[model samples]
Target: MEKVRATRYVLPLREGGSMPGLVEADDDGMYVVKFRGAGQGLKVLVAEVVVGLLGRTIGVDVPDLVEIELPPAIARYEADEEVQDLLDASLGSNLGLDFLPGAFGYDGSRVPDAATAQAIVWLDAFTANVDRTWHNPNLLWWHDRLVAIDHGAALYFHHSWPSRAPSPERFAAQRFDASTHVLADVAGTTAVAARHEELAALLTPEVIRGVVEAAPEEWLETTADLPDADAVREAYVACLGARLAAPAAWLPGADR
Candidate 1:
């Protein structure tokens, strides 16, 4: 991922639990910055980078991710107490997604075709992302294309680290219920199953390793069990590898 220093904090996007901010960077580009100090912590940022990279690898349109350096001065000038507090806590590097101008939230009026929907379903299932439902699509229709966003809710298994040893095998066998998925109606089981191999092939072990490595070292939290950043990265690689090697357990409607 590219590194860019945040020049300004434009505004707070008060949508979900963790309020990401819209900011301008030194590269003269605007980004939706996800703070490291947010309630969810560094694991969420790691998920954003890993799943975002995985989505892009499998032909899902996702915004470019960059590491943004946030200096202390940027926080001092904030007028809002809440925003200022967030900035003060997140005084270093944070994850930033290239902001798309004039992008509209996805509505069911312009549904994607079966193939596209299937790919999205497959991606969500593979990652165990439970956030993409009617309540929160986490998709944007920009430039006449469907762009996947906000994958921090995926990879829920990581939240248990330090307390419990990493369990790749358990994650591999986990099941995903697609009934509430935003694209469930359009994403038929047969289509997703048919395209499984093709989509899964894109996420080779080498590619998965690269995606895991893309995460900022500071964001990789060291736990009691996983005592180092490299160990955390290896845990992610192991979980993703295990899931890819055994998709039947998690693939939506695989038995059908």
Candidate 2:
């Protein structure tokens, strides 16, 4: 991912818990910045990049990701205390998604094609993402195209890392409940099952490692179990690989 410095703080996008802010970067492009010091911690950022790369690997319409450098001086002129505190805490590399100007939140009015819908559902199911429900569709309608966003909630298994060790088998065996998934009805679990191998083939071991590597080293939280960033990346690769290897265990059997 390309790295850019934040030139200006535009505004706080206070929608979700992370409260990603809108900021202009040195490249003269605007991006939605997900802070490293957000309430969700660095794991959210890791999930965002990892899942994002995976989604794009299989041809999902996701935004371009970049590393936004938050220099100390960038927050000097912030007037809002809350926003300033967030900026102060997030004083280094943060995740930046290309801001699609004029993009509106997804509504049932604009539907994705069957192939796209199934791809989205399969990606979410494979990643165990539970946040793409109707109420919180992490999707956007951009210029008549459906775009995927906000994957910070996908890899929930990592949150358990503080205490438990990374368990590939467990995550592999974890069932993905697509009942609340926004594209559940549209994608239909049957088609998702049919395309399992076809989609899974897109994420080769090299591809998985490449996506995991996209995450900045600073963001990969080092637990005692995983001593270094590379180890953590390996752990992610293992978990994802295990899940892909054991589809029957995790793939939703029907449209529930």
Candidate 3:
């Protein structure tokens, strides 16, 4: 639980959109460092950290998301050509995804069954996450299980319009996709079958509260003034409840 500090050395990483220089830290610990001024809000970083921590608790696979405090005084680019090219293309933009170096995709042929997809859909819906589609398969295949990644888009679009109603598009779309696949894979042992009980047992109200509570208060402060801290906490619970109440037989945590 020691917080890792960001330092001067840069390691090359495959570039992600909206940012430059996928570099590794010098501290010997592995992490993708997104510098502070890198276009994204602090909340996105907080969301990645919070959601990642929560997902891991219930058996979901998420990359380790951590914040690296880069020194503004440090000269930005290094001499490395690959890293330099990426930096040049993405100059003045603020954001970076620490690379998940050495991770590879699950064979496209072994596409996930509907049941596990159901769980993924449900999880994203519950969290109000906006990522996860055909374009960027944030779902990584590690150890024969679908690992979730890139949640900087969750609980989003709500920041701007505090009173805005939630959109069901992402939830509906994922459910539709999962249902079709689930039926197709009825013969196989789906992921939900193996871990639904554990996920259910772990996703208690307390666990949800702990993650949301740990979210940076500054992010909340930027939003419309919630009546009080409890009010903010209650809102997140309501959002989670809506997704959980949906009938998802293949949902890993639904029955438990």
Task: Count residue pairs with overlapping backbones in model 1.
Answer: 0
RMSD of 3: 6.1
The stretch of ten residues in a row with the least summed lDDT in candidate 2 is 247-256
- Cα RMSDs of all predictions? 1.0, 1.4, 6.1
- Arrange candidates by lDDT, descending: 1, 2, 3
| Higher-scoring candidate on lDDT, 1 or 3 | 1
Q: Rank the candidates by TM-score, best first.
A: 1, 2, 3
Q: Write the per-residue lDDT of candidate 3 for residues 1-256, one digit (tens) a residue.
A: 2344545445543454534344444455556554433456555655666667677776566765544444443346566664444444332322334455556754356766655664565555446565665555576766666777767777664455356544433332233223332222432335544544555567777777777776544344333545655666556555554444453632422332
lDDT of each: 0.92, 0.91, 0.52
Instruction: Compute each candidate's TM-score over C-alphas.
Output: 0.98, 0.97, 0.64
Instruction: Give the residue spans of candidate 2 off by over 4 A.
Output: 254-256
